[model samples]
Target: MNYSKIMFMIMIMLTTLMTISSTNWIGMWIGMEMNLMSFIPFINKNKNLKSSRAMMMYFLAQSIGSIIFLFAILMNSFIMTPIMMNEFIKTAMVIGMAIKLGMAPFHSWMPEMMSNINWNEMMVLMTWQKVAPLYTLSNLMNNWSMYILIILSTIVGAIGGLNQTSMRKIMAYSSINHMGWITAMMITQTKWFMYLLIYSITVAMLCYMMNMHNTYFINQVSTMNESMTEKLTYSILMLSIGGMPPFLGFLPKWMAIQSMINTEMMILMTIMIMMSLLTLFYYMRMISSLMLMYSSMNKWMKYKSPNTMMVSLMLTINMSMPIYSIMSFF
Candidate 1:
């Protein structure tokens, strides 16, 4: 809300644009470094110890990634390389991006960081902060190592969220899982940008609603003094986020799956599908807690009316499938 925060946000967007638009690795690396600097201040805006810690962790992780990235860029730029050295450079580049993007195996920092930040910060961190690294990674050659990273990311993301009670942590792991899918889109060279756009919108909506209600943990869902309609709406949104059919979130995944099938990536497709089901299970668990569990019946408790804009957004997400189907007929 303050000018300083607004400035940092603009810097974040500008830096991401710079990275994605750059023609060479060095330019992209500079953009990434600026983006990191901008985000650190944004993350620490609250001036609390928790936010400070998260900021430091993010800085350290990104610094390491950027160093590796810079080293690879310099190696590829200056040194005349043989086939083996070229492959080594490529591998280093991928690892650097993976670390920065918090892809699995380098992903422990993400959930830990997200769990410490507020919902708004979490939204930015999960969505916009990922653009530069993901775009960079996508432009790299698709190789065997990428497939291994994809499988590991999907597996770790799905399994990691199963036991998490913190909403932020759950979303963090969900982001990792979705990152796997997005990376697959890159390999297939399908609609990765489209997928990323849809993901950003979905995450923004979910974070908005969660922040509005000040909801953090799964248990809080059951205890909220909300009407049945409101609770049901929230549950539906969660299901949509879990990529349930006929929801907006499912559209991109459906497209990705079709692309994978067309490309004959049967093994990877199967694993992703199974992991998706696992994600859906935990989402359903949260929904069930909201709808089925009995809460304390306190007549004096004040009930906040649901935002009309948020309700409209929810309706749009829920009805996207039907809309798409109707459009396809045209």
Candidate 2:
């Protein structure tokens, strides 16, 4: 099942991981190029005209970002290389990474492409593919810029998701919101690995749940048509996604708040909390849709669960593990 494309993606990640750890912007740019080139064929593996068009659009967008990133690197190059970070160069790099991460104002391609792509492909596209580029962004910033991005991302991500009816678009905006939490935690990258870890575990768990339910379309899981089990799953996932108490998602936001308070970013902390309220609407909409008791037909319907109890048990543990990690700190 397209093993070669999968292998290519792995190589791209490996290459990017190596280059981003290096000292020069040129090396990082090369790594990003490697990643961008490798993903083109992967995105088009199904050979649909739509997939091809999405790939083309992704390529063009990444190309522009790369060129701008490379130009910024070269523009600031000097005969005597400065040991310190350059503001302009860092800002350019920030924009480049934002484009890659599907942050708002630069995130047009992500939702459209995610909607059309297959779930397994979308799984990789949404998750594993983000690691290397984001790690690079973390490397480029100190605690301060990270804090700024955290706030900016929360603002744009929440507001963007507020108006979306499309399921993939909602996830795309959710990705941005997730990025905000991770970026905020980046201020103490070493101390806050817990935040990132919890966030990743939660995201992967949600993806697994989505896959199991065959819920590619949000409408598919609505309370009106889906069985009671699926509806139960929808409620749990919405709580987890919205970082409501007792769910796995709350852990990272908890850590991020602590980190922000320690940094004396009180205003930023307040803004993040406010934005979380905005973000809650879309997730709660999904929940309300799932738990609606009225049925179009008066008969109870049953369908086989797509998972073994073991899988459900494991995901529950994944969510629980992060909670324990958070508790230990307190």
C-alpha RMSD (angstroms) for model 2: 3.5
Best by lDDT: 1
For candidate 2, report its TM-score: 0.85
Candidate 1 lDDT over 1-330, as tens digits, reads: 499999999999999999999987788899999999999999998878999989989999999999998888788886533234466788888999999989989999999999999999999998999999988887676666788889999999999999999999999999999999999988886579888888898888888878988999998877776655567667777887788888888888988898899899999999999999999988888789777877564342235454755666666666677788678679
Question: In model 2, which runs have C-alpha deviations exceeding 4 angstroms?
Answer: 79-83, 142-148, 188-193, 223-230, 294-306, 318-330
- RMSD of each candidate relative to the true structure: 3.0, 3.5
Model 1 residue runs over 4 Å out of place are 79-85, 294-306
lDDT of 2 by residue, 1-330 (tens): 868976987877787686658676777778878888888878888878878887887888788778777776777877224346577777877777778777656777777877776666666666767776677777665734556667778888889888777666788788888788777677654444565566566666667767666776566666245554445555776777788766777877877888888888788789888999888888888667667656554333364554546345644654583557667879
- For all candidates in order, the CA lDDT equals 0.86, 0.71
RMSD of 1: 3.0
Error of 2 at 41 (Å): 1.4
